[model samples]
Target: MPANIKALKARIRSVDSTMHITKAMELVASSKIKKATARMEESRFYRRVMEEAFADLAKTDSPYSKTTDSDAPRLYIAIAGDRGLAGGYNNNVFKQVKAAYREGDMVLPIGRRAVEYFRHHGAVLYSEDYTSSEKLTSADCAAIGRSVTSAFDEGTIGAVYLVYTEFVNMLTQEARTKQLLPLVPDEGEGEETHTAGTVYEPDAETVLNALIPEYVGGITYCLAAMSFASELAARRQAMDTATKNASDMIDDLNLRYNRARQGAITQEITEIVAGASE
Candidate 1:
């Protein structure tokens, strides 16, 4: 075969191999998405319940009920993915972190990428133990919640914010942040709305204090589940695009190779006829 044709053949083979890998990755991501979505939806419900409970507590006269701005630095919880090649999935979260970050503010990075990014930039780390966002369990969230709540209660941090990617649908994911501390009570809601049909065990204040950590933990776990699903969806999309591009390249290469071979064959026939006539 001609050198040009040989090179084209090599390129086709390479692209075909790449396509296989990307196609496999796409299938893997797709297979996991359904379960991830289900988990995300379940956690969302739990998070909502916890949030409403906190909002009800906010209506009370306790110190934790009111939102306050202290001189202390804010704590930012940044959640990213452990792996890359997900087409900006991790970068979006990190961008949100940089946009919201301030001097002396502490960061709790919940994935390998987030940890590496912050450490490279010399940001203050709250904890480096949580290295995998997807692997984090409810227990892990509880520990994180307790630690964070303690810091807030002790006035070490003035506020708390969670930065993550929200999965809106299979094709849509959004990078957003939500404030988690200093519970904001619903405006115009009367105290009777929460206190009317409920009874506290020890007292409302005590119950509120205990519930705060659970609320935070539950919210964190649910958001993490959502983010995990988002990450998988992003990976699936990226791989699918890659697979299609590879297929296109392979087709183009095959066309070129066929044309080259046909030209070579026509030249050979012409030489054979000229020799016979001579």
Candidate 2:
């Protein structure tokens, strides 16, 4: 074997090693995507139930809509990813959050990326660096729910709103803001108005208290599902890109190896012919 061919074999070995690593990463990401997708599906059901509960309570003329003080501060719960490479998934939420903020509003950033983004802009009232995993359980949503509600009760925040990506479909997701406190009645809906005025079972305020927390829970659950799904989709895409890049590099390296082998083979043949003639 010529020295040139030997070197080419070594280069091929290095490329093979790289391919193995990328393939392993792809498999790992695929498994995570499966688990994350299941969690997103389960959370969807919880979200739907919560929405239905809120809709029912609204029919009772819940006082939750009318009980709000004028002099209160607004809170923003901005959820972003800790790491990026998933395209605009995290940036979309950040953009929406920046667009939604008004003067004198406070922010509660979730995820390390969100905290870093908002740190220089304004006051960060609260932040969670890394909570929630590939699969978001009810407990995860509830924990976050408790923190925001606690802030509201302490008068540290008045209206709490969440800004994050909403997974619409496999290929389409969008950034959205949802009100998490002072639960509002679903817009364009009202108590069934008839010639006879509507009546409440006990009272409007009574029903509102019972319904408000459920509304918050629903929003939290939905946000978790959407965020998790977005993460998986992003990661899958990132891994796919990396695999393609590795393949391209291997192609280039193989081309170099082939040319080097040809050159060495020609040199050896020429040397043998010259020796025979001498």
Candidate 3:
């Protein structure tokens, strides 16, 4: 009985230690989530503005609107987190990429997790320079955009897609794949029905060419921000769940320990009473 009680006490201490770690992790994730979500919001707003500009540009006849040859290879820019502990966050984006992968497709992974995953699957990489999303800067995004544009312009790839996790809410994130190249205008959309009397300074084509790289870089940054926010939110939730479960286990163990101790005391009291009656 004493041994059992001692074991239960040890288990309770272990659970308490785990709870402390998980609670600390939860707090850290919460703090990061706030900053990440704020950045994500700003990025999304910028991305939307850029998209609108590109849509308007697409309405004009330009070389960027033309599609490449059908046989050209496709490129996928997969964005994920550098680490895990975010429940299913990384896996969800990875699965979306896997579902769309093809024989001639090339991958440009933007995170450590993505690098590891693509390498393990033996996928061809566009470049190894973009391997950590956490440390990416605007300049880095611009460089990546330049590389992607160069490949597209050189006729090496026909299309480019961006794979990421869209932050929907605190508890929800959706994996999405968005087309980034060819600049195809939607039918019946952005038609010059009511012109705003906007005139291109040098020419429309020149402005479009100048904006394409910035647009791509902006979109990539936006997606990266959203992915980071999603990762932090997911990690916070996971750690919260773990902490709650540990608390419950500790409570159960404490109850069991008390019961065993009480039983031992009762057994000793009964032995004393019998000896007195004899």
Candidate 4:
């Protein structure tokens, strides 16, 4: 009985230690969420503005409105979290990208996990410079934007897609994909929507071409921000659950230890009485 009680005590201490670590992780995640959400909101607004500007090109029948060639390879910008223990946050991103992957598609991964996963699985990479999503800045995204646009212009890649986790709510984070190139215009759109006095300085095509790189970079940054926020939220939830489970385990172990100790004491008292009677 004493040995069993000793084992239970050790188990409780181990669980208690784990509980503290998980609680700490949960607190850290909660603290960073405010900043992450702020970045997401700002980037979302910029992305919407750029999307509206791109719509004007569709009305003008810019060459970019045409569909990409069927033979050319596709490129995917996959954004994932740098660390794990965030539930299925990382796996969902890989799944979303692979669902649309083709035989000759190339990937430009923006997170450490993403870079490691794609490279380990033999997927072709465009570049490995942008490796850590946690350290990513707008400038890095802009550079990615320039590279992808240059590839589009050179006829190297057929299409561009961004795979990211969307922050729907505190309880819901969903993996999603967005097409980045060959802007698909709504069929319902008409040229009459163009403002009456608006004029392109050089030409609409020249203006759009100049804006494409910025558009790609801005959207990438915002989407990455959303993904990062989603990751943090998921991690916080996971750690909370872990901490709760650990607490429950500790409680159960302590109960068992108390019962064992009582049994040992009762046995000792009976033995002493038996010796006195003998």
Least well predicted 10-residue stretch by lDDT in candidate 4 = 188-197
Error of 4 at 256 (Å): 1.8
lDDT of 4 by residue, 156-226 (tens): 99888999999999888999998888876645554444343467779877898788888889889989999
Q: Model-by-model lDDT, in order?
A: 0.88, 0.68, 0.85, 0.87
- lDDT string, candidate 2, 66-177, tens digits: 4467566788877777666666887888888778777677887766677777886666556653333333456656666666667666776778888878777656678889
TM-score of 4: 0.91
| Backbone collision tally, model 1 | 0
- Ranking of all predicted structures according to lDDT, beginning with the best and ending with the worst: 1, 4, 3, 2
Cα lDDT tens digits, model 3, 239-263, are 9999999999999999999999999
Clashes of 4: 0
**Clashes per candidate (backbone, < 3 Å):** 0, 0, 0, 0
The global Cα lDDT (0 to 1) of model 2 is: 0.68
List the candidate numbers ranked by TM-score, top first: 4, 1, 3, 2
Off by over 4 Å in 4: 186-199
- lDDT-wise, the better of 2 and 4 is 4
Looking at model 3, residue 34 earns an lDDT score of 79
Clash pairs (backbone) in predicted model 2: none
Q: Which portions of model 2 show Cα errors greater than 4 Å?
A: 1-19, 55-73, 102-104, 115-123, 129-137, 153-155, 182-184, 187-205, 260-278
User: Distance (Å) between predicted and true CA of 243, model 3?
Assistant: 1.5
